[model samples]
Target chain A: MNERVGTTVLSLTGISKVYGEGPTRVDALRPTAFEARAGEVVAIVGPSGSGKSTLLTIIGLINPPTAGSLLINGEPVITDGVAVANLTTMRRRELGYVFQRSNLIPFLNAEENVRLALEIDGVPAHQSRTRARELLESLGLGKRLAALPGKLSGGEQQRVAIARAMIHQPSVVLADEPTAALDSGRGRQVMELFRDSAHAHGAAVLVVTHDHRTLDLVDRVLEMEDGVLSEKQPA
Target chain B: MMDLAVRDIRNDLSRFLLTAAGLGMLMSVVLAMTGIYNGMVVDATVLPDTYGGDLWVVQKGTQGPFAESSRVPALLADRIRAVPGVERTRSYMTLNVQHELGDGETLRFMLAGLSWPDDLGNSLPLAQGRALRQPHYELVADRALGLPVGTSLRLGRDDYTIVGITSGMVSSSGDPLVFASVSDALRIQNDLASEALRLERESRVSRVRRSEYGRDPANLARAGSAAPLPVTSPPPVTAILVDVAAGGDVEAVKASLLGWPDISVYTIDEQRELLVRGVIDRARRQIGLFRALLVLISAIVMGLIVYTMTLDKMLSLSLLKLLGAKQRVILRLILEESLLLGISAYLVALLIGELAFDLFPRRVLVQDLDRLALLGVILGLSVAAGMVGLRKALAANPNEVLAS
Candidate 1:
């Protein structure tokens, strides 16, 4: 990939997520520590009910971990149990998320959907529109700029969603089964896009997936089963 | 925020427009009700306005000619004219009678009797023909009576020709009015059946003949006996309408009339107050109650629509939260959509209300003040409706998107 792993951009230490208390208590994730450096693509693979999605959510700053600390660029943003005051700000400015179904706003077309992410960061409308077009074009969505989510194919919709996520140039891009809704060929294209995005933008990219056919596109792969994580050798 | 709302509405334009039009029709009815109330007030004051009299003189301790049976001597018109500052006086008599159209249809009309020439402004202005120039058997009918100017109608023993047609001359109860000469009114008021008159005369003559004077001619001659006795006594006129000279003191004239023995006087203001507070009070209350109920219903409907729309977009709202759109942004979007719907509906209601005026059976009076007040009410209602959706939006959880 001709990319050197830079400083750590996302770090999770002793993180755990518990559903309830007493007898009915369940452990969604069991005390996990993970780090991903800039210019690196990391994948967590597991079957249903594994803790892959849980750990990804914790690093994405969506749900606070039960007992853990989160550090961004080596700065503590969550300690013990409390999230910092700037968690939302950090989430908006530093973290990008791509979900399983693309989850694009149905009313907005591709260009507008991508532009919204930049506009949320207070970017000017003209600049945001320009940057949105550029990002979509780089993802090979230039001709479908005005196509609504409903009009786009499944693969095209996912590529538009990827453009939306990367338009803001966030420090970390977190994805959860983004290729689950696509075929193997489209899934490979999406995974390769993520690898290229991570290397080209010098951002940390983490993905949770069950598909093993596209494992070679990621720099490192981690396996999770029964709420536990183990480093795995790539096939 | 507006862009989002616009796009959303455009995507479902038909549904949104239908909902707004439904609300608009309801609002139109509400506005029409207000106009109806105003029309009632207008109807009640039409007489006082057309009278052009500074003061009204009627029987002692009576409200006025409209509220009660007021009887005053016809001669009192001259007496009122004698007072200083009195420019003119007219003996005014009013009564309700049914005119048979002869095809099994009868229409009730209020008959107004005043002096000919009507110099004191006691007659309604003509819209078609000349006013009553001849004294008797000539009438001026209001256009609402639907009588042509050349038509003739019978009241009692006489047929009167409709000489003039006036518009908007009606009683407090919305009955059409007909103006006739004072003499015709007196005869109509005092007219009795021939058989009844004959029987009454016979009874009187028999009583006189049976007395001692019947047997003694010498005493009868000394008593200045008459061969016949009068059969009927004329009924008293209704009231005396007095017009003061221009720039004259109405209170002074009213005070002078108040000193008389069996008469009451009312200035124009008192007459108006009596009509409004006395005759229109019940109607106003009923309309007010209806307006309150309608406003409440509109508010509830608005809230329901807004709440439904918010629930429909629950997933989108949750995703926006996950995408880091703040609570305020979501709230603003919902509120903007609500306002857009409300304003559109309000405009539609106004347009429909204006068209409905001509269709109402009674008069519908639309005033600018009423329109402005309704606008304020609608805006307030829109904000209140928006609050319902805002509550739902505020409770949106970002974590829900992750679970989905």
Candidate 2:
């Protein structure tokens, strides 16, 4: 894990988001510079409506930043506020996301939920199934593979979500309050999984969370107030 | 690749199957309407098709025997037979009568004169018994009338025994057809109750007393008696069916008969056209309108169902989009689900139609072409319905997943 610690996996320079024009204009996210290296977990904490979700959305490539240069694995995906490459392909091959709710597709079982990510990337069914089973087993969900999201508990569901995110071996994994629905113990377990995913798998991890009980599990903490972001060392 | 559509359907199979079943019931109605319309066409043209005559002669300026009222002299058959190129001619008469079934239940049917001894209804499609042998009391009844062979039915003061059972034979109005000899049909047409005979005799006597014949006591006395009045000539036949000699010019024969000035001639095909296009045109329109409305209703229902199912899966779709799924993936999911639902419903409709179509009062002829055409329509409708859900799916914001 330490061998790949210094490798830069994600970089954003002067990233900002503005919603409207004239008086109706609102700054959802202010210009911010940030980076996460392999084998590291970075946590973003802020009050309600403090642009944490906005920042996460931009980093996830779900929404375009108004002015920014963004790079993943040393390749420029966005430069000078314009998408230089296909954002969807970049997201599919380079990024993974875990929402506040596990957001597991209700119809698909735990194993299928993880397999779908690989399928979207055009992986063959046998390889995808093998990879999904291995990943779910590593996440301690082997027995619950055929169980649907509705049939699983909160922690089990989040573990399945983590397996789904890690199945594609994306360079960066972003979580927006992934443990908001889980209890304290389950939330801590989920944070430890995120840490292991970053440290062991060499993926750059960023999480937006209001819960501070799991703060020590992260390597760095970034605080956001209104539309501005500021970094602080993890306690 | 994983079949996301199939996975979703299996997740909620009961509801999906139930929805398909409901839609199938509606589609079955549409199929039934199409079948009824086809049956009507068959019923209207069956006689002309089965008669296999090359030409028909009817009263001038009339469509006759099936579509309009026509009365040509019974002797017109002899004249038509003498025309050039005419090989054979037979007198044809048809009338609708209500026959009592001995239990106060009346069966209304169209009684057609077969010109027996000349035309014994041998050309009719007999499903069970023999053709008419005796001209007077023998009848060939359509199976739709539910009269078995050898069953006696009372019609116009005479009991006629069912000799042969014809299948799928009906009038333009969908009433069953019963064939009897021309003489028996004529007698049935002319039969009257005893009170009506007395009234006729009194009227004839009064007419005789007022004329110059009143001075003759013998004529007056004979007119006042209960004895039946002497017949002047045989009853007029409805029309004459003519068969042209093989290798003969039917058009020339028709032209020769057209010169009579009192009768009109038509080729068999023309007579069929008159019956289909003129006799049952209104019914066709009515049934066609119903079928169109049913199809429209089915489309609307299918659209609503697909839209609602999409609505239920909006979050899942947004999640898939956020997970970097291409737009076409989500579109395929919705479209595939809609298509499966439609195909399943169509199969169910076929099963229902097979089970219930024969129970309808009118014959239901479900032709293969009609079935294939309807399947094409259903496929088209399913795709069109899928569009309703696709619009909503494509518009779903992936950012919603972040908020969730």
Candidate 3:
């Protein structure tokens, strides 16, 4: 395998993003460069209104960079730092995301919600349901399979979210303040789950968090300030 | 994934149940409309069938007995009886009148004058007691009137005893029917004031007095000088009731009666058509409108629900998008959710409709065809609602997941 492909599941070379035309324009991210590799856990930590969310959005392909190229597994998907159309398909097959509040479907139980990710992919009912149970059990939620979101605790819900992200076995998982609703202990436990999921399952996991107590859980950490990515410590 | 619609439903039973309950009420109304229509059709035609006539003989060119007034001499039964196809014939005097029960509750009733004797020896299927056999005083009433047998009622200035009560024999207007002997029927067929009868008697006396004064009452005035009056018998009944033979062709018999009088004839089938086409059309149209309105409201509800659910799961949608879940998949999930809700509601509505019908006096039919049609409508509506959610999901940006 090529070094670029193995070392980086996602590599953004000098990406910059700006909103609007002239007077109302804003630069949410300015010439940021970063890479996330397979089997590695990374956190993007920043305070509120520090362009952290904007940076995360750009990396997640929700918004395009104004400049720079983005490559996935050594394949260039963006050129001149501008996204081409048809990005929706590219993101779905390659990426997974976790949100701050679990954001689980209230109508669906833990297993069902996780199963929805597979079902949305056109997986057969039996297989998807089976896989959902497997994932939930693996996440230490074997007993909460039939329980609805209301019945599950904050930590359990996030664990379900993690299971859903990995259910499709995507190469990359993105988390946006995944433990914001959890207490310190549960938050730390959820962070460890992501770390273990990435390394043991060969996934590239990028988490955006405000929880610094579990910073050591990640293999590497990326800090952004006014839209620039800086490496703080080696893996 | 799209199949998880059922799974989701199972997971959140309470939410599903509440939605179904609301939906069930709507369905019940729909079913009731169908039942009411059936009742209307049956009620309007039931009277024509009871008369046991192939055709009605009336004054020409008018729909009589129920819709208009028609009168012919009571003697016409003789001529009608001689018709070739009229194997057996009977005369009757029918009138619609209001009677105040002993309890002071007024109800409309049909006064029937029966002429011919039957196998029961001029009797009827009575709830209690016997048939009206006496002239001017005996009466037979329908059991629905809640009147007791052997009771007496005042008809105009005359009092008559209720000798019997028949079950299920009602007029077109839901009035209870009463049977009186032909003599009494003809007597009160046209009621008049006591003063009017006395005045006519005094005129006769005046004629006798004038004759004694040596001037003939008829010769006392020129043709234009005096208001001329003629002595008359009571006006004949409006129409006669005849029972056609079981094998008799009603249309054929109806054609024969068309030649008899100043009235028009109507068969039971013809009566049904008139009711549906003339009187009941407007109500049917109203029901159609209500059905459309209900469908529109239900569709809007589904759209709003799916959209709200989508908004709640925006982050998850973006995540799915990032993981290469197709737009179609997301769209399917939204649609599936809607369809699930619709089906659940549809079933609930039918159940409620049936239960309501059991308790209510009015008719309500929850037909299978209507239920199937509702299912189709709900499925289509849900699919539309899902599209709204799909649009929202597709609007989510995966880049948000990567943000710091």
Number of the top lDDT candidate: 2
lDDT of 1 by residue, A55-140 (tens): 87788777888998888877788887579747767777788888899888887889988887777667888999888898899888
What's the i-RMS of each model? 1.9, 0.8, 4.0
Q: Put down candidate 2 lDDT per residue, B1-404, tens digits, no spaces.
A: 79999999999999999999999899898888889889999999988887768888899999867778999999888877777788899888888998767788889899889887889998999999999899799899999998799898777788889989999999888899999999999999999998998887788778877988777889877776767567667989988999899999988888888888898888888898899889889989998898889899999999999999999999999888888899989989999999999999999899999999989999899999988988998899899999999999998888888766
Q: Order of all candidates by DockQ, from best down to worst?
A: 2, 1, 3
Please give the range of 10 consecutive residues that has the lowest summed lDDT in model 2 chain B. B223-232
- Rank candidates, lDDT, best first: 2, 1, 3
Highest-DockQ candidate = 2
Off by over 4 Å in 1: A1-5, B119-127, B186-191, B199-234
lDDT of 3: 0.71
* Residue A124, candidate 3: alpha-carbon lDDT: 86
Cα-based lDDT at residue A198, candidate 2: 78
Which TM-score values does chain B get in all models? Answer: 0.90, 0.93, 0.73
Q: Worst lDDT window (10 residues) for model 2 chain A?
A: A1-10
Per-candidate DockQ vs. reference: 0.49, 0.81, 0.46
Clashing pairs in 1: none
TM-score, cand. 1 vs. native: 0.91
Docking class of 2: high
Least accurate 10 contiguous residues by lDDT in model 1 chain B: B219-228
Model 1 over residues B245-290: C-alpha lDDT tens digits?
Answer: 9999989999999999899999878888898988888999999899
